[model samples]
Each structure stands twice: as C-alpha cells, then as structure tokens.
Target: MADTFHDTDALVAALSDADLDRPPALVANAHITGVSVARALSAHDVPVIALDRTDSGVAPPSDAVDYAGQVTYPLDDADGFRADVERIAGALAFEPVAFACMDEWVRGFAETEPAGVRLPFSDLAGVERVLDKANLYALCEELGVPYPETYEVGETDADEIVERLAFPFVVKPAHKRKFEEAFGTNVIEVEDRGEFEDVVAEAEEYGATVLAQERVNVAVGADTSLASYVPPESADRDPLAVVGNAAVRYPEFGSSCLVERVEEPAVREHALTVLEETGYHGISESEFVYDADREEYVLLDVNTRPWKWISMPVAAGANLPMAAYADAVAEEEYEAEAATDGPRDGRWVYLPDYVRRCLTDEAFWDVLSEDDWRSLFSGEFEREGELTTGLYRPSDPAPAVRYLTGEFTDREYYCSC
Candidate 1:
C-alpha cells in the first residue's frame, strides 16, 4: 500500500487534471538514476513513489526514494509495467510523472501511457531515434551535425577495416543498453589491428553488432555535452541545460563527474540543430568532445534519459528535471526556467570518489594544483559560480553515502572497461 499523506490533494492537483488525490511522481527503477530523479522532484514538494524490478541488486534505496511507497513490478515485463503504473496512478486519481529511468522503462511508458500519468521523455519515434546509436548518427549526418566518422563493420574482413581506420579507434555496438549490460562497458578502444580483431570477435560473441569509429581527439580535456529540456508544445528553443564545462575524475577517460555551467556556442548550436530537426521534445543529452585537430566539438552520442551529473545544471541555475516536471503537468504554456543567454556557472562533484581517483592516478596528481585542493576541501570552491555535489546532502544524506559506497565497491567502473 502507498503511504498516506495529507497533501495528496495538492500533489494530485499539480500532477494532472484529474480530481482524485494521489502521489505526484511515480519513479520507476531504484538505481542511481531513480534516486536522483526522486530527490530532484521531492525538492519541489512533489510526492514520489518508487517501483522496482528487483531489490536484491539495488536496495536501501536513497531515503528520498520510497517517500510515498516502494512497490515491486517486473520492469522487464512490459505488460506488467503498464498494469502496475495504471493501478498505482488510479489510486491517486491523477497521472503522476513517470521517471522512466531505463530505456526499457521509457519505451514501455511511452508506448502505453497509463491514464493521467505524465512521462518525462520524448515521443516513441524520438526515443528510438537516440536509443539506437546507428540511427542517431545517421540522423546527425542528415542534419549536418558533426559526428565522428563512423563505419559499420558487417562481416567485412577485419583486415579491410584495419586498413581504413587508424589504430586507437573505438569498437562499440549499435545498441548501447544491451551491449553495456552484457559487457559492462560502452565501447572498447583498441590500440592495434590485432587488438581490434580480438575485441570485435569478443563483442560479436556477446551479440554485439559493432561499429568502428575514428576516436575524437580529447587531449585538450574538452569532453562536453549539451543537455536540454524541450517542452513538447513550446516554440521557445532555448536550452535548459547548457554545455557548462564538465570534467571526469574516474576511469581517467570516462563520463563527466563534475560540471561547470558555461556556454559553448558552436557545440550548443550543433546539438540544438539535431533536436529541432527531429522535433524532439524532452530531456536529451547531446555528447561532444573537443577535437583539437579539427578545432571544433565533435559529436559522440545522444542520450534520451538523464545523464550522470545532470544535477549540476540545477545547481547552476537551471533545474531541468523540475522544468520537465512542470512542463508535464502544466495546464497551458507556462513560463519556466528553461535557459537564458547569460552565463550560469557552477560545479557539481562527488568529492570522495574524485579524491580516490586523484590519489591513485599519477596523471591526475600531476594536474591538481594546491589551490584547487584547498578550495574544494575548504568549502571555498566557487569559481565565480557555485559548487554542488554528487551525493552529499545535509537534508537527505543517504543517497550520497550510498552512491559513494557503491562507487568505491566498483571503482574501476569509471575506468577503462
């Protein structure tokens, strides 16, 4: 049973047009993503209930999760997902915002939207557009967005592929979710032809339909992403999440851990082009890396769901998750904090995780200035903006502690996989 709250009427009134009282948010999946979504919404006084496929792998969900109640549903079972969401939403008498954290969950919710439930995602076609990497790259090509030179290797002789592409290229599957789940990595970088062949063979053995792409030069430390919250009916195209400078502390070469709010016009324009061209409306992540050789940001991948470190934007003055929530429940064209032409700079970090990486990596140690350390640890880390965090929160400290716990347990997760 869902927890009884006195503010149910107010929560229901905000989430949907229905008259019945219910929780305002239905967060599916209970991993880091779900925890983040639940916490973000809760900050806005939105009541949230959590659901899960299993509890063994992820439990003791951050205290923010299960704020309303924690229910179990077979997320893999699409029919079950729709049924469960329908039942829960009906109880509250209004459609709650579906976090829809995973690709499967997003697809499920989008395909069969329970009555009165609002989901923070793109349309079905738009969801498929970004979920399939090959399709996404193809769309970018059509729209003239700069993506790395990508080659689909379909039974072509490995020697031929080796002849065309230089060494240190990446080998990844067309579909990212299944591939990552199976191998625990997004892509593998091979240094030589021999390594490439071996990697492809191993990938194929694990059901990977591989692509060989030129590795964008990141020697300048310019890994960037332009995240945005696109309202479905809004004519305004300003980005809610800007390309605030982002940095990584784990895996050495990995996803961002800390983000600074700043604008990269060319990078931002390229990503906005793709979204507008696709008529995509939702939270989307357009990844790019600075190509020092090309002197431009080269596109990498497009993510439909929230990216790691998304909370950075909220700290930097753009609360995207909330923007999407407000958009979902708005009765009309409501003005929300989507974006501004000016700069909103800030940093969001997981201090312990970063400290662990810095202490262990010689390369990391070489770049850390004394002032940077002092500022970060001394609570004076502002660089004309502000600094948020990955996990630590005084109001709700469990998620931060839980993430750092799991992050250390699987330290190499951010490293070369």
Candidate 2:
C-alpha cells in the first residue's frame, strides 16, 4: 500500500506492518527528478516511498509515489535527518534501497549510512570531491581528462588572470551550491577585463571562491550527457551507459531542455574513467561540451544522482535506477543490457522550459538546426519512439497536470537540480 503519512507514529506503523510484501524504495525528495526515479523503479514492480521535507503543495501527488510527509530537511538539519532516516529504516520489513536526487540529500545519506538501507552513491569524501569543481578539475587533470582550462580566484591575481586568458571567459564558483545560494545562477559570463574583475569582486563580497575558465566555443548540437550506472564492486558487472545530446537548454547555458538520445563513444569513455577512478557506484550523469576547435569533448560537470532527464534512459531501454536496485539487493552478478540499438533515437523534452525558451529567447532559434526546427512545430506527441517528455506519461498524468497548472503558470518551476 502506498500510504501518505503526516506523523512518525503512523509512518512507522505502516512500514513495520508485516503484510507489506516487498522492501520499498525510499526516495529523498518528491521533485521531478525523484518522481522520475520512483516511476522508473515502479515499472519493475518495486514499491516507492517518497520522503520530502514538507508537502508544500508544490510536488504533484503521483500514484507511483507515496509521501513521507514533513521529514527533517537533510541539508538544514543533518542530525535530525539522520534520526528520521534511522527511525524510518528501523520500521521497514526489509532494507530499503534509498535514492537521493539532490546534492544535499546525497551528502546527508553518504555521511550517515543509517541502518537498514542501501545507498547508491559514493561515500561522503568521494562525493564531495566531485561536487567541488576545484577538486573535480584537479582530478580531471591528474587522470588526463580534458576539462575547461581554469584559474583559481583567490590564489591567482586578477590582473594576471586577465593577462593570461583571452576575453569573454566565465566566472563560476568552486563550490556550485554555495554560489547558487548567493546568486540565482551558477555562472557569470565576463565579456572583458573590467567585467571579469567586477564579477570576481562581487563574488568575493558574497564570500564565494570563484574560478575563471576559458569559454569553450561549444559546437552546435554537441552538448552531450552520459547517463550511467556503476554497480557495487561485489557485483563485478560492466557499467550501463546511455549518451544524450542536448539540442537546447534554457536560461542561457542552463540544464538541458531538449535532448536527443545519441551514441558518442569518446564522451562515454571519459565519464567511465572518472567514475572508475573515484570508485563511484550509482546512477551518474557526466556533461560535456564538444570543443570543435580542439576536436575533442571537454568534460563540464558530473551529477552523482538521477539527473533532470533521467527518464530518457528508461525510454531508451536502459533503466539505471532499476539496475542499481537489483545489484544492491542481489548477490549474483548483474549483467545490464548493453547500450545498444534499442529505441535510442528519440527526443526527450522538458516541455515547460522548452516552450518558455522557444517563446522568449531569440538566441534559442539560432541554436536549432534545420531538422530541429522542423521537429519543433511537428505537433507529434503520441508516436511511440518519437518523443518522451520529462513529466507527461499516459498512465501517470497527475504530475504533468499539476506542473502545468501551478508551477508552469507561476514561472517558479526550475527544478533542474
């Protein structure tokens, strides 16, 4: 039974009930990403329980997800979150497989591996190393992976940075979440020396350690993401990889709004290398921008959890969340379906953001190739293997309705974390 519980006593009672057949999948937040994970696992007949900080009336109620209402916020109160997690875990009939969708949730679960649950991400230290861009860049350098050329803000002099690098570089935080907290966006594009210095000073005023990175002239239609799952070491199985090309993004260099499932071997290779180097075992999405000048793909960022377009992989015949869950539960070797000639040639669209960008941004039109433009107004939504939306599914229609009614109208639905 997928029951919503407002009190711990009721929640514990429901979970502890012996009649509950299978061990439920505990999802951290009920945001779009978490909802997608829940749906992915439910397709395999796994029960899903979504634990959020509060109901808040924002997240759409889904048949695929049962709410664990008003839990302690993982980022705000780590101790309380740990206690709550343990309390919930102790009531379960079997060890629940936990999936954390946000950075804070990942950190919370990693730091406190509460009893009676299976975590899918790396440990605290390993996850932190990847979350911090400075540390990630260092690791990329050590492993000979190509990332954007970067200059440290505090350590390097402002004048020297301007002198060394060309104009129109970017200023971003070493720690992305901290900066995003201070400012709404993660990056600031500096057009010249003056703007570069100004942005750096502004970031310092907010006590954020920023970095200067060369603006990679990304090739059109070359922004790619590799969604993968690395099983635990005991499973000893090959990782499952699915490559997605971001045809368009919103808010100028933000998350993918429209993606095309494609095969890019080099992008997959670089991402797997990093995951192997760190011993990261879980669902991950590694982003890359193709540098046409260098004829290479430059690694941009890595997400250790289910990404914004995670549902795309399930549509493409590679279910990452299910693969992780199976490996975590079974002792036998798990051989995932190879990334192959399935329904991989399709488009995944975050409908709200894609439509918003298309209507508002003039530059959004310039990014679209001839075929992309044709497909934009094609008005074909029902064709199988043609398109998969981020939220809308025939069987699960409430979430999409909620999104379009409330969040989409208010313009506060940028949950691309």
Candidate 3:
C-alpha cells in the first residue's frame, strides 16, 4: 500500500490494521523537542500526524501533519483550539494515540479532551504538581530524596534571602514554564543581594512566583535526564525508565544536544522512588546534575512530558513513548519492558544544535567531559556512534532542506533557539 493515501477510511484501515506491528497513531505539536517522538513512531511504521502550532509548514517532526494552528496556552482561545483539533482528527479519521510534547499542550488537551483523542499523562492534578516547582520539591522532601535546598520568600525582596543562602545562588519561578517564557531564562544567578533583588523584582513584575535555591556546583558530575513511564494503577506493574548522560547541552539550564544512554543505579532508584510516592502513572523526565562536591546526583527538575531529546532513548533500543501509546490506545494492558544492555555505546546527536553551541558558546563546549572533541569536530559525536542526526532522514528531506536554506543562505529565519 502507498504510504500516502486519500480518503478517511483508507487511513483508518491502515491505522487500525493489527497484522502490521505499526507504531501508534498520534497528534503532537511540532518543535525540535517533539522531533524524537515523531521519529520514534515513524521508525515503527506508526502513522503519525504532528500538529504544528507555528504552521510554518511541516518540518521532519511535522512530516505527517495535516493540521496547523496556535497551541499556546492562556493566549489562544482554548475551546476553539480543541474544536480545530477534533475537526482535523475527524477529517483524518484518526484517534489520537499517546504522546504530548509540551506541558501547556498536555494541559490544553486534557482540559478539552477532543473526541477520539487521548494523552498518556497523569491526571490534571498530577500535572499541576509536576509543573509547580515548589510542590515537586516538597514531594522530594517527603520521599527522602536529595533535592536542592530552596529558600522561600514572603516578598520578592532578596536582601535577607542573600544573607541566608550562599552568595552566588539561583532563583527561578516556583512554576517553571510560565517563568521561562517571561524571563527568557530557566534559572538566574545573582552575585550579590543587589542583583538577586533586581532579578527577583523583575520576575515578580511578570507575575511569577519565584523561589531561591543553592546553586549546587555541577562542576564535577554529569548532567543527566531520566525518562520514565509509570503505567496507570490498573496495570499493577513496575515503571519502565531510561537514563541519559549529557555530553553537550545548550545553556546550563536548558535542553541536551548530545547524550548517551547510561545505567546509573542511584539516579534510577531516586526517580523510581519519586514515581512510587506520587503513584504517578504517566511519562516524566527527572533531571539531575552530578554535584561533585556532594558526590551524588541532585534532582533539578521533573518534566511531565516528552522532553527535547526523548527520541534518543528510542534510538537506543528503548521505546518508553510506545509503552504509553500502546497502553493508552490498546484494549490489553501494556507492560513496558526495560531497555537492556544493548545500545550502551550509542549516542543521540542533533548535528545542528551541537555545531551551533560549539561555534557560539564556549562555556557549554568547554564542559564537554563525556564527548570527544575530535569526534564532534568530524560530525561523528556518538561514543558508540551517532545513531541519528537532527531530523535528517533519507525518507524525509523537506525539513533538512528547509533547515539548510535558513542555516546557510538566509539567516533571517534561522532557528537559533
């Protein structure tokens, strides 16, 4: 059968066919973050239609997309967005399989759950807890997990806060996503109380609830991310998860560009413990920075959706997203198997971002401990090997072609972020 087809019935038949161990049908918004989820599904022969919010036309992440609209939260009309989503899915004759790329998108989908659409994430309340930094850190304390020491303030003033904590500390939003957009930074460092007060004042101006915490030096340890799937309680099974050690990332407080699958028992144990405490049965990413001073991995943040590099795990022979997708849409209970000893040497690399950082930011490239400079110089970043490069797939040339035009010839639309 031709991969591209018209008529809703033909598409439905292709999606619903059981003989084809195809990947789950999906509806995800487009971004570099969602690229991994889309690629993972496409590799499985799953029929996926990424929902592009920018409507810039389909990139590789949006390769199979049919609908394009604004998916922003609190800005776009919520009910209208849902209507548009449902209309598009109905026209395509597809039931949304399990996957969400952004937290705001997740909440939007859950709030107005369109007909035939399903998101493989926690309940709305669970999502709130994960999105709220204060709530998550409190949960960590309850679970006896080692989280960064947070300093709460009655006001946005920082004079006393500075005296109480270390001189160079980090202050960020109690609710991260909101603050990230408002401040353009995930975490801000203040050398003195004056800068702290100014940063906090600016944060308050944006109506953000800010929190101050000790900046545990990540000078020695690796910056790691743990992707996990805790199935709904009905499954009564253990959660399946994967850990990646970052080789190169964008900002000290941002997404990874180069990473490799690793087996960190302590990191795994803490993540599972938190999942068990919350009884969370959904997809989550727990970020930890190896604090050399403490000789342990300190929990930094927990993301309750498909992260920026989520596709890498799938490339390394693990399909946590598939487990959630299968469980969400299938009649039978889905038991996710743990990814094994295979692909240990494999690395997930996004060529564009890696090279971008190397040219623009010395601070990030200077901290490349787990990666070889020579390999990155040669565009061969993977320790085992570069498993994948950006969204540059042989079958999908449009995104790469689009990428090149802006990257080289035209700098106006270049995606630096």
Candidate 4:
C-alpha cells in the first residue's frame, strides 16, 4: 500500500516512518528538479540515493543518504542503457521510486528499467512528439491552435529566406541552448534584412538550421503562462493537475526581463485548449502574448518540461514535483482544479538587471502604464521569491555553493538553459 501525507508536516511524518534500509533512487541527481525534490524529501527524513553521471561534489546533508555515479545516455544502444539500469538498480537494492528529471535520461530509464521503477511518461513516440519543436508546431497547426509562423532555413540563400519570411523577424535555433557559446542569445530579433543575414550566418556555426519566425510583440503588455499536467488517457477532459499559472513583465518594450503572476480565465482557457488538442501529457507550460492592437492573446511557445520559475507555483499551492510523483506512482486518480481563485497580481523582479535596464533603456516606459508604475513603486504588488535563491537553506549551503563554484562536472544531467 502507498503511504499518504496530507500536508507538509504529515508528509514529513510519513518520511520519518520510511524504512531507511531501502531508500528511493533520484535519477539525474545533478538536476535542479532532482536537487529540489531531494531537499524536500530530506526535510522529511526520507533516505535518498542519488544516481547521475557525475558525483556533483556536494552530497546530501542527511547522513542517511548515498550517492552512485553512473554514465547513461539515450540512444539506439538499448543494451548499453539496460546494462546501466541494471547496475544502478542493483546498487540501490532495487529502489522502488526513481525520480526522472532529464528528458533523455527519463526516456532511457523508462525504456530499460524493470516494472518496479515507476516513470511518469507516455510511450517513446509520445515523448518524441513533445520534445521536437517542429513536431509540436505541426501538431498545433493540425489542431487549429494558434502558433507563431515558422520557416526553416537549412542551406537556402539568405535572400530567399527574407523573401519568404520578410524583415523584422526572429531567428532562433530549434533548441535554445544548442549554440549558447556562439549566439549568446536564445532568441534574436532582426529589424532589417542586413541583421537577419548576419544572425543567420552566425547561427550556421552551431550546425543547426535557423528558424525565422514572426515576432509576436506580447512583451509590450504582459507575457503570461498556464502550466498543467495532463494524463495520457484523459486528453478530452480537464488536466490531471494545474501546476503553474503566472504572468511576467519586462523592463522595456523590447528587452527580455523578469516575469510575474496575474490571473485571467481567458488566458487559462486558451492554454488548456492547446494542451488538450496537442495530447500533451506531463508538465507543459503555454506562453501567451497579450496583443493590444487586436485586443487578444496570441500563443508564443510551448515548454514540455518544468519551467524556470517552478517554485512560484509551489508557493501558491500546486506542488508540481509532488503531483508528478503521485501521478508516477499511481497513488491517486489525477484531478485538475483551478488553483488560483481570483486575479491575484504579483511580480518577480530581477533586481540587478531590471534596475540596469530601467536606467539605460528608453523603451522601458512603454511597457508599464501609469497605474502599473504607481503599484510597482508603492509596493502594493506581491513578489514571489526567486526560484534559484532558496534551494539551499543557511543550515545547508553545500549543494548551492558547489553548484556555483564549478564543482559539479555533470552539467548535462541538469537542465540546460
């Protein structure tokens, strides 16, 4: 039978009741999601066994924990992955719960592990559809959901691309972190044909095709998101859980800045419709741009994994990690409910960069109306804590410090920005 915990204290109490002789295995240990979940588990005195590609230098604060390093990759080599799973599983005495944080790692374990290790993903084909942007956009188009206009430029001439996509567009790699060293920007805006050609030329060094897309200027007003977890069987009904719902604001009309949370039912309905039509199960976040000209919201992009601001929703009550764990273990029939009742306005400001942008950028004033300016300065708005800040408490700063000081060599195990 599965152990149940009603609240944080009850969860901790249940952890205190666990048999430390056999601890749960946290796969992809170096990942922030793994680290956050491990820390939360540790608070409950649950024994944790961390398994990843590297040692990550820092160990769990709890003495009841152990670390095992294993090199595993997702590829066509089924034998190699199965062997690694066997080794890791044997090392932990065949731990029942294996928390998967990385996509490739998750797929590998899901494909190779025995039935005892529970994974919260659909079949391999389902994973592929969600991970690939091209596939996702194609699915969205078929479902009559709105998506940014995208054109792939593999080896085509620059003039041809410009002719097709026109100037004042965006050129981004299919995945943001593929060319981090070369481009230094996730999404690049091209004002004219000259800038577009220059950016495309630079993108070629990364061995990726440049995707020119229409620039949706939703950053001018507010960029909001609706995140949820759906089940494979119930795509037609409500989601299994609503994990996150928040809005963000930029300092300038054109600058990329911090985000916040604001409640809007219209935004939620649009996001939910897209998720359902796409058959997107697991954690999905849909971004929307409020266009003032049309007085409507336009879909920007869809993230198939946990978001950077995951902690905000946890503070607001929908703990995605816990919900995902529950769903993975089949402890309860998943149910979705609106977490945020009314329109609660809040903002998460990136203090250092937000200050700098406001001082230097003239377009900053275009983003905020007179009322927003008054509310911001008056401190009437609620501010969510930074996601990266409180992962390690003062009592335990080893993990956070190690992560910052380059002590961890397993960078791939963690989510790449």
- 61 Cα displacement, candidate 4 (Å): 4.8
**Candidate 1's TM-score:** 0.80
Q: List the candidate 3 regions with Cα displacement exceeding 4 Å.
A: 1-24, 57-74, 92-94, 155-160, 251-254, 332-344, 357-386, 409-417
lDDT of 3 at 49: 57
Off by over 4 Å in 2: 1-9, 56-60, 192-207, 331-343, 361-383, 408-417
User: How close to the true structure is residue 154 of candidate 3, measured as C-alpha lDDT?
Assistant: 56
Q: Tell me the tens digit of each residue's lDDT in model 4 across 225-294.
A: 7756665564343463332333223334433245555556777776777666655566666776766655
Error of 4 at 221 (Å): 6.8
Model 3 residue 146 distance off true place after TM-score fit, in angstroms = 1.1
Q: Enumerate residue pairs that collide in model 4.
A: 247-260, 247-261, 248-259, 248-260
Candidate 3's error at 347, in angstroms? 1.0
lDDT of 3 at 69: 35
By TM-score, is 1 or 3 better? 3
* Model 4: residues with Cα > 4 Å off, grouped in runs: 1-31, 39-48, 55-82, 93-116, 154-161, 174-210, 234-237, 240-259, 292-294, 331-397, 400-417
Task: Give one digit per residue, the lDDT tens place, for model 2 in 1-417.
Answer: 244546655677666763546667888777788778888887777778777775532332777775455568777888888888888889877788889888778877988878778886678887877777888888899999999989898788888888887988988998776677767788888898778877877777788889999999899767998998888788787887789998888865667888888888889889899888887788888989999889999998888898778878877878899898887777434334344665456677887787788899876564445554455445334345456777766566767766667754655543544
Question: What's the TM-score of every candidate structure?
Answer: 0.80, 0.86, 0.80, 0.65
Cα deviation of 20 in candidate 3 (Å)?
12
Candidate achieving the largest TM-score: 2
> What lDDT tens digits, residue by residue, belong to model 3 across residues 1-417?
122422333444433342333334444555555556665655545666555445332343245433223333323677866765565455443456746676667777767777767667777777777777888788888988888888665553456677678888888888766677677777888788788778777777777888999989785328887877788887675677778888676654455777877888889899888777766678888888888788888898887887767767666666777778767866645444335654344566666767677788766444444455555545454324546555555455566665676556534421232
Candidate 3: which pairs clash?
A: none
